[model samples]
Target chain A: MDNRPIGVFDSGLGGLTVLKEIIKVLPNENIVYFGDTARVPYGPRSKEAIIKYTFQAINFLMSKNVKAIVIACNTATARSLKEAQSKYNIPIIGVIEAGARTAAYSTKNKIVGVIGTEGTISSKSYNVEIEKLDKDIKIVSKACPLFVPITEEGWANTEVAYLTAKEYLKELLDQGIDSLVLGCTHYPILKRTIGKVVGEEIKLVNPAKETAKDLYDILGKQDILRTVNKDNPIYEYYVSDIPEKFASIGQQFLKRDMDDVKKIEIQKY
Target chain B: MDNRPIGVFDSGLGGLTVLKEIIKVLPNENIVYFGDTARVPYGPRSKEAIIKYTFQAINFLMSKNVKAIVIACNTATARSLKEAQSKYNIPIIGVIEAGARTAAYSTKNKIVGVIGTEGTISSKSYNVEIEKLDKDIKIVSKACPLFVPITEEGWANTEVAYLTAKEYLKELLDQGIDSLVLGCTHYPILKRTIGKVVGEEIKLVNPAKETAKDLYDILGKQDILRTVNKDNPIYEYYVSDIPEKFASIGQQFLKRDMDDVKKIEIQKY
Candidate 1:
């Protein structure tokens, strides 16, 4: 069984949501997370720039000798997942495929809604993946570009955030989809508010949880589950920007003190 | 008189607001602007990272043989202005000082309100600058971090934007301030909504316009104003990420076509 840490990276602290789920599922496994806070909000960037930044983040994770890599950022998954798989020999997992598969299996009406960054919606990666699994599945996707910034600004519970969610999700709800995928990693933090707005009938598919399940299954199949002591598994966090701010906001997702988060220059990778 | 173009740069298209004011004040001078769209939103990054990025942007503008540099970003000005001025040989002007000077001069009640990103507020640069000019002035600052994303998402005119602006501005209004500074470059796009919330009783200071005026005075004193072009001065734009998005959003600021914008890599600098 492999004992190496699983590498997780996103444009910012949103990846901590995925990391939290992964830790819950595999308590014994070590984790190395990198948040590219210095160059975050990859949603509005071009495909070429996303690819370049994602590659650098991946390379930095690889330097830490991770056994597998998890692309926690939806924009990176939509734009550069295939390139990542081809570039690295280690097992690579992205949220888009896992989320799409779960939505395909869980939806009863073959209708789904996806909300993500501009790049993710514009790429139509989830649409293509869901369609590949079931040809009849209809997907409605909207670019909720403000969600990431809202979460970063710590306005998740504020009335302004609720109002913004209503404005951004009104069209998606009007489509009458049975299931909605929280396509971007930062979206789960707003799950309670979004769920309330979208109503209880609409199933909110948290891709971070599904991705953790997918990773658990993959590790099980490969017989690579760590046999180390669960209580003492080491966890490391790295960011390319302000460590203090990361430590502060990251506590919401990690549910623990981030006193040890270290800042590193990822561009050198 | 020196005939070289004046260089202006931001983390993204927000700097176009400053560029627009510069054009209005100095119609005969050529202008060159760079927007680091790929790595925009320097507001949340570390001070060191912001300084590094600003230095790189300055180096890029210097490569273009710019006569002077205008840091059109408030966060950058708050975090990196001193470092930038010390590092670069050319005269560098940031929006913070220009804004603080204007706010100091405009406030009659000595209660001046400032709105910007979290990093800008946390730095306390504007407060320090204003207090230095006149210690009796009371500074009330609020961090409106969502304004950038709201503007970026094209929600500047919707009812949702007005609601968001009201929520963010409520506390500042309660302080009974006579003058307010749009501290972030992106805030200018939301000026109407902000003004509506603050009402006509409070004077809103546009730092970009003040900075442009300062630039005019500096150019006049130095005898570096371009005198060759009276009718048709050239303006060029460059971005580190999406050229198309920059061009489109830039149109809102410059009130002209973005045909002259070119995408270029600035990471090397």
Candidate 2:
């Protein structure tokens, strides 16, 4: 059994939501999370830059001796997941596959909606993965570029958020999608607003929970599950920018107080 | 007369608003612009990272032999203007001084409102500059961090934009501001929405126009104004990410077709 900490890497703090899920699923496993706060919102950036930055984050996590790595950011996953799995020796997991699978299997009408950052949507990673799972499953996707910033601004429940959500989801709703995938890590925070806009009929699939379950299964399959139960599993947080800012928003995302955050020069990786 | 291009730099396409004004003010001058689209929204980044990026952009412009440089981004201007002026030999200008000066001078009731990105507002550049211009002018500032992304999404005139502006301006309007500064470059694009929210009584100060005037004055004072009128003054655009994305949004900002665009490795500079 491997007692090494699992590494969680995101372009920013949105991955805290995924880490929270992981903690719930693997209570005894240690976690080391790195948020690339300096060059965040990988949404509008070039694919080359996203891949480069993703590798750097993975390299940093590898140096920390993580048993496995989870690319928690959708843009990073969509752009660099395949290459990263090939490059790293450890079990490298990305958010897209599990998310796509869940949406593909759950949709009764064979129509699914996916919303994410520009990079993730344009990559068509969700469409690709879902199509592989079921060729007949029709996928509709749109890039809601403002969602991340709106979430970060803490306006998730405001009128502006509702309006923005309605504007973004209208097209997908018009296409009669049965299931919607919250493809970006940050999108989960705006679930209430999105739900109000899309109504109760459409199932909102959050990849964070499914990803955690996938991580647990993979660890067991690889015979790397932490067998011994610790009184307290250590959780460490590292960010490339202000720790205070990360801690503030992170507490909101994780739904718990976080004081073990530190700043690192991520560029060195 | 200096025939070299005048460099304008921003975190992303937001600077094109400022560049458009510069083109109007100095029709005969050649222009070179660099947008760090790869690592944009400097609003949420650390001060150290902002300064480093600002210097890198400046260095790149210097390498291009620019006669002068304009820090077209409010966040970069607020964070690095003074240090940049000290580091570079060529005349360096930032958007803050002119913006602050305009608001400070135009206010009728001595209460001026400032709205910008989190970085710009938190830096208190406008407040500091306005206070310096006139100590008695009461300044109220709020960070509307979502405006940039909303503007970039091309929803600047939509209901979402109106709601966002109304929410952000509520406090400033309640405080009875006589004049408002569109402190971020992207904010100018949302002028119609913002003006509607704050009403006609409160004059909106677009720093782009004032900044262009400031640049014209500085060039004349420094004996660097372009004297010879070329029928076609060259305008070159460079970005750290996809040039096509920049050109498309840039055309909207500039109100002219942009064909002279190139991609650059900004991290190297």
Candidate 3:
């Protein structure tokens, strides 16, 4: 057992979904979550830039003596996870692998649909991972660019979300996919809207849920699970910009209060 | 006469609206447009971060020997215009002044509505500018955070856009605004839909139009309008990240072919 905190970072508030799951599953574990609010939506950025930003995030979290790092953002993970794992000594887990594995295990018809940002969909990381699991599996990928904004605006269950989801998932649904992977960190929040659009025929896989379990398994195996006896576990959130806006939007993703948040210059890391 | 190009920069592609207006009004002026694609949404960032990023954009433009600079993004202008004007040697113009003046002039009733990103609205720059023109003028400002994404997705006229616009503009419309300021650079793209929601009675003041005219007046007063007589006037476009996606999505904003776009590391500037 270890007392060092676990580090988790995402492009922005979307990662709070992952952090929320992490807190729920690992109740005693202290988390150092960083949201790169200054330069978010890593979806449209270059792979090199994403890797650079991911390293900067890792650098910041490592400063707090985190035992492990989780790349909570699908775009960041798809663009940089392997490279980061090769370079860092501490075990690094990315959402793509766990999410893909879960989809692979959960699917009965061998047809899977992926919905995410332009970067993650275009990266084809989910497709590659699922294909690696089974050569005959069929993959359908579509980019739902407006979903982030819809979720960010807290219209996840609203009519706008349903319309937008229907518009984006029409083709994928028509393709007869049995299981769908929410490939973006923010996608999980829109699961209800997405489920409504796809109906009861398709199963939705949230990477956050699987990623939390992945972290738990890895921590237990490595014997680095937080063993501190402190009555209250503190989670620290660092953002590159204003913390109030982060806290407000973050509440939507977290579904809880983020009482301890700080504004830091991420570039300095 | 100064033959150098006019520098126009925004947090992202929204500035293309301003550049489009500039192109239509002043066809002879060579233009250098920079979109901070990597750090696109300055809307929720801190003032310090916005100022820093704005300077980096300014620094990059200055390197290209631009004669004057236009802060085309509302968030950037709201956060850093005054500081930028004081610090930079070249003439700098921001959208807020021209937008406010136009709204002030266009409104039959003193009640005006301003819609923009969170940073632009929260800064109270539009209200302050309009109030400076007439102390008794009533201003209703709303932060339409999802507008940028709708415009970015090129869904300006779609049903989702209509619904989103209806949702955001409901409060402003109920407040009985006679004239509305398109406070953010991107808001002009959603003009038709906005007009549809607000009806033909409420006049929409586009900052891009007024900003272009303001540029014309400033260039004439300074006697620095481009006098170069090349066969084809060059409009160099620079962005902080991948140029391919910018060229594609930018066509929606620019409504023209962008054959000369280059990727630059904005952090270096």
- Per-model clash counts, in order, read 0, 0, 0
lDDT (Cα, tens digit) per residue for candidate 3, span B1-269: 67789999998888999999999888888899999987766765668988999999999999999999999988888889999999998899998899999999888879999998777787899999999999888999998878887887778999999999999999998999999999888888899999999999999999999999999998999999875566457899988876345787788788899887888999999
Poorly placed runs, candidate 2 (over 4 Å)? A1-5, A27-30, A43-67, A79-90, A223-235, A243-245, A264-269, B1-5, B27-30, B42-67, B79-90, B108-110, B135-138, B222-236, B243-245, B259-269
Model 2: clashing residue pairs? none
Q: In candidate 3, how many Å is residue A110 off?
A: 3.9
TM-score of each: 0.81, 0.86, 0.85
Taking chain A by itself, what TM-score does each prediction score? 0.94, 0.95, 0.96
| Cα lDDT, all candidates | 0.86, 0.89, 0.88
What is candidate 3's TM-score against the reference? 0.85
**Candidate 1 C-alpha lDDT tens digits along A1-269:** 68788999998888999999999998899899999987877776668888899899989998999988899988888888899889888888999898999999989988899998777787898999999999999898888877876787677887777888998889887888999999888889999889879889989999999999999988888888897685678889898887345777899877777768888988899
Docking class of 3: acceptable
lDDT of 3 by residue, A25-106 (tens): 9999988999998887677667898999999999999999999999999988888999999989999999999999999999
Model 1 interface DockQ = 0.39
Candidate DockQ values, in order, are 0.39, 0.52, 0.38
What does candidate 2's lDDT look like per residue over A74-176, in tens digits? 8888888988999889999999999999998899999999998877787899999999999999899998878887887788899888988998899999999
**Model 3 chain A: lowest-lDDT 10 consecutive positions:** A240-249
